[model samples]
Target: MQALPKTRTDGRLPLYARLRDQLASRIANGEWSPGDMIPSENRLAEEYGVALATMRMALKQLVDEGLLERRRGTGTFVKQPAFRADLFRFFHVHDVEDPDGPVIPESRILSRQEVDLPPEVKRAFGDDAGGRCLKLERVRLWAGDPLLFEEIYLRLPDFDGLMSLDPKEMGPLLYPVFLQKFGILISSATDELSFGTATQASAKYLELPANSPVAVIERIARNPVGRIIEYRRVHGRPERFRYRVNLGEQHT
Candidate 1:
């Protein structure tokens, strides 16, 4: 049994709440990863010297907040939200020959550098913002046809080695790279999509006419601990844009 840290001395917080906070800190700190089953409630109760009911209550709070999942027979595991999952829900590269076939676009990094962040990016990073960040301009292609132009930004020092990575050795995705190479887990993101005219840069990469209407997406990604990790903007022809979201049961 791991010795639990006593919650703040103030005692204003309830025992269960303090226990919940400590366990959540472990998850956020990556001490317990996304799919690991946490210690059993009885074990946790014994370790923390709390009542079984108190331990259950702490676990319940985390489950309700979407940070933990209680499996009927498999015990509880940490919950990880992959905001990138929405990328598939919102768009797909269709094969013209077989329109319903699954296609994964290939990414090609065109340029990389360290640069001062734009005001919006600085605002997104807030206090974690640095003087400069690693920026990459890339394109995605499907069936050898260019489909999207992307600009990705990463905070400095935390991602210092990223600028030197060879594009030839990179994969089609970025989040996995952040996880494997940098120990950064992109747990969630906020994305906005709208119509916009293609800039010269986007037009050049996506091979679209300048000023043509395009689908634009602005995404802000965060790690498990809620630190901003990436700010990305992408442009694609409007015809290929799609979006969806699921909600709880509708009220009568």
Candidate 2:
């Protein structure tokens, strides 16, 4: 393996961050490919002439960013690149225009249910699952690899016959199905973004180490009548994905 570039002493950034930046740049330059094992922590420590903890901190940052993946009983490897999505625009994964992007997203249906609504869900739907609600747990993949895990809730009245639809036909997009089946037009939406470590389930789905960092996005889609039609929680691989926002200048 080639030696990592030496760090500059003039910069004020943390040492670990500098190491993380260097590693990322190397990967972008094609020095590392997906599934290729990187040096062990001890080896990196020796190469960088840093303490073990410092090496670990640098690796952890990359793992959180999704650039590197850890396999139990094995070492770290580079990860598959991810698509870049702009936060300011409305997007559905199926409608994405990039041909090189994920064409067929593999999906695993973890659970499906019709049960009494939870308080938070009730607030969003306005009506309890007093009648029924279809709950779906799904993991979405890109290029046949798992990329996201999602939990989606839809009121029963709006999708009375949803169970009859073939899961394979749904792809990674659900909003369009809602529109076709129930005329639930999503007029607007509100989203909240936060950082979190992976849960046991998410770690398994993403094939990542326990406590690996992830990006969490929570969204609520409303219809023209001001009814909350869809509530979704999405867990994304941090390193592979980035959220882009465009800011408009304020008037003087």
- Which pairs clash (backbone N, Cα, C closer than 3 Å) in model 2? 65-239, 66-239
lDDT of 2: 0.68
Task: Point to the candidate with the largest TM-score.
Answer: 1
Give the 10-residue window scoring lowest on summed lDDT in candidate 1.
81-90
Full-model lDDT for every candidate: 0.80, 0.68
**20-135 per-residue lDDT for model 2 (tens digits):** 76776656444665558998999988887878898899899878866788989999987654333323122234435775554446567887777667666777786444545788
Local error of candidate 1 at residue 89 (angstroms):
3.5
Superposed by TM-score, candidate 1 places the C-alpha of residue 228 at a distance from the truth, in angstroms, of: 1.7
Q: What TM-score would you give candidate 1 relative to the actual structure?
A: 0.78
- Prediction RMSDs, each to the true structure: 4.2, 21.7
Report the C-alpha lDDT of model 1 over 1-252, residue by residue, as the tens digit.
Answer: 556576445567888887887887777677887788998999889988889999999999889867889999889998765433245445666658877655557888998999998898899889759778889998987778777888999998988888777765568888777766776777668888888999999999988887999888899987644577899988887777777578999998
Stretches of model 1 off by over 4 angstroms after superposition: 1-22, 45-67, 79-85, 95-103, 243-252
Alpha-carbon shift of residue 229 in model 2 (angstroms)? 0.9
Candidate maximizing lDDT: 1
